[model samples]
Target: MTFEYAPAPESARVDIAPSYGLFIDGEFREASDGTAFPTVSPASEEVLADVARAGAEDVDAAVRAARAAFGPWSALPGTERAKYLFRIARLVQERSRELAVLETMDNGKPIRESRDTDLPQVAAHFFYYAGWADKLRHAGFGPDPRPVGVAGQVIPWNFPLLMLAWKVAPALAAGNTVVLKPAETTPLSALFFADICRQAQLPPGVVNIVTGDGRTGAELVAHPGIDKVAFTGSTEVGREIARTVAGTGKRLTLELGGKAANIVFDDAPLDQAVEGIVNGIFFNQGHVCCAGSRLLVQESVQEELLDALKRRMSTLRVGDPLDKNTDVGAINSAEQLARIRALAEAGEAEGAERWAPECELPSSGYWFAPTLFTGVTQAHRIAREEIFGPVLSVLTFRTPEEAVAKANNSPYGLSAGIWTEKGSRILWAASRLRAGVVWANTFNRFDPASPFGGYKESGYGREGGRHGLEAYLAGPDDRPGERHGEEEDGRAS
Candidate 1:
């Protein structure tokens, strides 16, 4: 006998304005050119809202607002800043359900994730940074650490609200004003967050949000008034931003791309390892930057692990993002869907054995079934490129040394996972791994107090905890400006 889950869609209603203007200072205004673009629901390809597209003139205005607001905002007592952050945290929690529904509609992520994971973490980040706001002197940065001033921040669509929380909470706590540009595809949640700022009675210009595509972000980053730039997105864009800001006296931090690995040893518990592997790659439809897309299993247990992983993958439900039972939701955009499809095709072209569950997808929205490729090699495109979709690549290793070698073979060093019961083996593998954050036994965990970022091509500057404060705080020898954040690596809880 088999049991089926009934459609359990969230019934909450969120009021999204048909047209939204840029949130500058304390009010919303039309773009300089008065142009707007439609933001669509990836789940159904439905046009949700017409959002104002920020141009060069609009970006300059936002930077100017942030620049003007920085003086009073930075001069506020740490305790006062703490009050505002705490208020924002409370406001987030108060309207979390509404935000969760909005997130599901706009971002095409499961309601379960938006409600259970992203919203909670968003509030927690603000609360965590609030605690640090009044205690910055004790954070080990310096006795009088100064704000970086007028931060120009760009965030991705994967975890829209959460990424905003990660960037905005810290910058505000460190006493910096911000001009934030949410990704083109998922700007509704960020725009709603602008409303949350108003509800919290946050000061005008302290958290300006400009909604638009990559051109808007580039304009904001290049603006002369922006003292610092913080961005989370593709590595290709990150490299370009690095070059754009080099020697320009602007402090810059980038949290970019990754293609992480999840290693399973011979003695690992089969069921537990399978679960970890599933969570590592399939969470958020594998939109996470630190997703463990590569699986390196010990040769002795490769066949057994493959069997278990396939069984688990067969059970994942792919459907509406708002459905409570949906495990994997739509890909964020049609462009991203094309990329995933291309990479999966490349895996086949490269002689990798591809497998997926017998899952029927919704007819409308952009979707890709959860997939895994076996017989994969480090030289394959699927193994090296960041697919950014719910696709896993499996490879085998004969020894621990080989597993580490294969795991570290990628240019990305954001995150990696090790599964084994032995404490010593976990330690040995973790110590030798070149990734920034290594998970043992479990995967895809996060917390507000822990620092997250990557090494090498994965980009740099830590976000969260005390180390995160360093990015926004001026150095001892520095005058008043600097830049920071994670590559969205697996985290604390």
Candidate 2:
């Protein structure tokens, strides 16, 4: 017997302006050319706001503003900076409900995830970095590290605010100023964050946000004044950014695409592994960069596991983003929806059997049902490429050696998961996996103190914990008066 769930929609009336301007130097202003684009809700295709489309000149202006503020911001005592960060963290918690509602509307994620997962993490990142602001000497880089000057950050639409916090918090804590670009499709949260900066009394130009598409991001990265670059997006775009910044003396960090594998061994807890598989690929409608889209199961228990997995997925509710009961929401955009459709078609064309539970979809929104592809081989396009949707490709492996080999066979290696009852087996598989982040039995778990990133084509460098601070910091030698070349008396030069 099944029971129906009552619709519990959160109030959609958040205070969003009908129009938004570029946030530069702690003030909102129109783009230099006054060009603007409308950002629509992916769920209803309704134009939420006409956001300014920042041009090259706007990007230049933002960089100049960041450059201007860098000296003052970087000169502030770490303790002072910590106070500002702490204020921002408190403000974020205070406004989390509004921000979460705004995020769900703008980015097409379920309200629960935006409220429970993303919002908490966003605040935690700020609080975590705040604790380290005055304690950098203990972080082991050096006794007195210096800021890296202006940072040019470009974050993708998925996890918009969380990504912003990831890039911005550490940069500020390390005494660096930043000019950030949020993805075109979801720029409201960042703009709202600009208000947060204002509310926290963060000094002008300390954190600047320019919202636009790829062209604007390119300009920010290639700007002559930028001292560091941080981007989280597709691998293709990452490579292009790498080429743009090469030989330019800019420190670059990228957290790009992934096709992570979730391996379930025969000895694994079947029920727990099934839940992990669901959350691994279905969370955020599988828009996550480190999502485990490929399921590598032991051949011995493949049928039983598949049955359990299908039964679990059948219960997932896919509907309105504002609904508290919705398990999956709309796709981020029509373009992303089309791409997911094309890839699913390709999977079928390549002879993989596809299955999706019977669920009615809303007629107005951009949506795709949670789907699974079985009888998938390693050579299939579904298994090789990053689908970036709520689509799972299942493949069976006969042995642990084969599972490890198959898991590492991708061009991407951001994260991987191993579900086994034996601790030795978990360690053995984790040691062999090429992923940057590995989970023994759980998936999609994150902490501000744990460094998260990937290897290979998945991109380089880490983005959390004490290690993340190094990206925006200069070593002792890089700081002239603090600790440079040794003096004859064996003191700081």
Candidate 3:
């Protein structure tokens, strides 16, 4: 007998206002030009709320507010800053249920993921950074490191609240005020975060949130008043921001795209390797930037692994974001679905064997079944490009050296995973892999204390752990007469 799960939906406990405005200087206010756009639920195509669109004028206002708050905020003792972060972290935990449901509604990810993965991480990030506030001197940057004034942060929609936490928590803990802009497709949770700030009674202008499309991000990055810019998004947009901030004396950090590889060795445990492959690619409907989109398996185990993988894929449930039993939900938007479809078609045209499980999809919402292309070579478009959806490309390698070579062949060096029982081989392969983060016998694992970022085109600078604090701080050399390698006589030794 086949087991079936009862329909379990989370309660809609969070109240979303019909419309939302910019959160600047500790208040919700309208855009100066009165421009607004509607945000819709990707699962049902229902309009969730109309959010104000920030233009140049509003970006300028947010920057000015952050600049104004910088002196008083940065002057506050480190212990006081730690108190504010602690409050924010506690409040996030208290409101996890409401935020999780809202995230499922707006972002079209499964309720289970929102509750289990996203919300917990969001709260933990704040809690971890809160501890670092009073311990900066011991962090090894400098004895008297200073805040870099205001930070302009722009985050993507894949993990809206989590990304916001990653950006805002460290910036605030380092004594820097922030002007953040959530992605155009999803802004509800960030607005709700503004309410959390109010409940914590965080001082005005310490954390400002602006909502809009790419133009708003461009404006925020280009604003002369912003002392630092941190962004997480596509490589195309990252390049644009890099050019915009060039020669402007602004500190910049980017967490961009990736096409990570998940390699399975013949000596590995077959069952666990299959599970890792599934989790690495299908989690969050494959919207993750560090997703293991490319699968490189040893030729000896290729047939056995493929059979097991297909059998596992057949059992995955795809539908309703609110359903607790669902494994995959709707795509984030219609445009993204189109891109996935086009790339899948290209894969077929390039003579690769394409396969998708026989899963039913809702008629009204944007949906794509979990897909995989086999017999893919390095020259295939599907293998080279980032599909950014629930799609996987399969290739084969003969040895550990070949696996490492194929994995590092891509322009992106964000993340990669190795599956084997040999301890020495794991260490050797990890040393050779060009990615910033590598996992052995596991995939997609993250921690608040572990620094996460990428090498090469996947973008620069770390986002978590001790390294994250440096992005928001000014080193001793930034001050007059405190230059490194300088003698007391004010000349280089």
Candidate 4:
């Protein structure tokens, strides 16, 4: 008999205000248009709070505020700036439990993940960048690097607070002021972070949070005052942002979607490989941009691997996001749930064999069972598309060369994984994998010190470590003692 664990829910310890407003210039104020929208809990369909919607005018105000704060902020000694980041990091750690519970409620991710992975990484990212703040000269980005003025950043809902840290920490470390927009579905943590800024006593306008939909993001990115733009979301939106900033000469970075391949060699340790596959695809309800949705197994061991994977998948607990024992949680929103359902339906229509464990879903909120598909081919929609859900497509490959070819066939180059005990073979396979981040014996691992990004359509511009600092700084040509005259078309010489 299977042991059913009793429900252990985390208490809602955070004090969320009934209404939230746009955080601009270190102050929380209502949108100029007085428009507000409700943010709901995906696990219970409960309305959490009313968030002010930032319109174009609000975006402009945020940009202006960031622009005004840039000079004094950039002029501060890097060590002084580092102190603020360190303080923020400490504050994050101090209030991690509150943030974790808030994130779980806001994002519909398992409480275990919000507490263990999300919150810790959020704090660590700030801590990692804090050290780099005072050491820019030795960071290999030329001598005495200068901050780019105001930056506009847009983050998605899948990993809200963590993504905020990924974008905001490095930008501040490099002495650039920022105007940030959290996804409409998950805006509370960003607002809470604004409070952290107040607690840290950070200078006004160093970090600003705007809450709204795509229109708000569009205005923020296209604002003439923004010196840089960083986005993390769908490939389609990333392309639009790229186009919007093309002729404006704004520095842009995008960390977009992926349909990563988790390749299992015949000689791999079966038990560990199955665990890796589960963690790779199902973590955060598979809302991750670098989720390993495609499983490429050697033909010789395909049946064995699939059997093990299915058995393991059957044990996953899917339920309340606040439950500490829940392995998978609710879909982020109704719209996202509909998209996942459509893509999953396409997988079945294309003749892939769909299989799912018999598990009960909460009736009221958005929920999708962990699913897997067999008899999948590279041409199958399930194999080719990014179904940002808890779904896996299993495809077979005969040799390492074929495995490499099949894995690299997708438009995304974000992440990939290989499971094998052979050192030489692992190195060879990793060398040929087109992904930005490759894991030989593990999957879905992240660190603040490692630079992460993608090639091709998955987007570009590395984030994290010393490389991330470059995204917020001016190039050598624009720095003091390195200013070259402008060309005929106003391009830097």
lDDT of each: 0.90, 0.93, 0.91, 0.91
Over 349-413, each residue of candidate 4 has an lDDT whose tens digit, in order, gives: 99999999999999988999999999888899888889999999999999999999999999999
Task: Look at candidate 4 and tell me the lDDT of residue 103.
Answer: 93
Candidate 2 residue 53 C-alpha distance from true site, Å: 0.9
In model 1, pairs of residues that clash are: 445-491, 446-491, 446-492, 446-493
lDDT for 450 (candidate 2): 98
Of 1 and 4, the candidate ranking higher by lDDT: 4
Off by over 4 Å in 2: 479-493
> Model 3: runs farther than 4 Å from truth?
479-493
lDDT of 3: 0.91
Tell me the tens digit of each residue's lDDT in model 3 across 1-493: 4466787777667788999999999999999999999999999999999999999999988877776677678878889999999999999999999999999999999999999999999999999999999988888789888887788999998999999999999999989889999999999999999999999999998899999999999999998777789999999999999999998888899999999999999999989998999999999999999999999999999999999999999888999989999999889999999999999999999999999998889988889999989989999988988888999999999989999999999999999999999999999999999999999999999998999999989999999899889888888667421222324332222
lDDT accuracy of residue 194 in candidate 4: 97
**lDDT, candidate 2, 1-493, per-residue tens:** 6668999999756888889999999999999999999999999999999999999899988877877777677878899999999999999999999999999999999999999999999999999999999998888788888887788999999999999999999999999888999999999999999999999999999999999899999999998778899999999999999999999878999999999999999999999999999999999999999998999999999999999999998999999999999999999999999999999999999999999998899999899999999999999999999999999999999989999999999999999999999999999999999999999889999999999999999999999999999889898677422222323321222
Model 1 Cα lDDT, one tens digit per residue, 137-246? 88999888888777899999999999999999989999999999999999999889898899989988899999999899989888777778899999999999999898
Root mean square deviation (Cα) for candidate 3: 4.4
For residue 213, give model 1's deviation from the true position in Å. 0.8
Model 1 has an lDDT value of 0.90
Model 4 lDDT at residue 466: 83
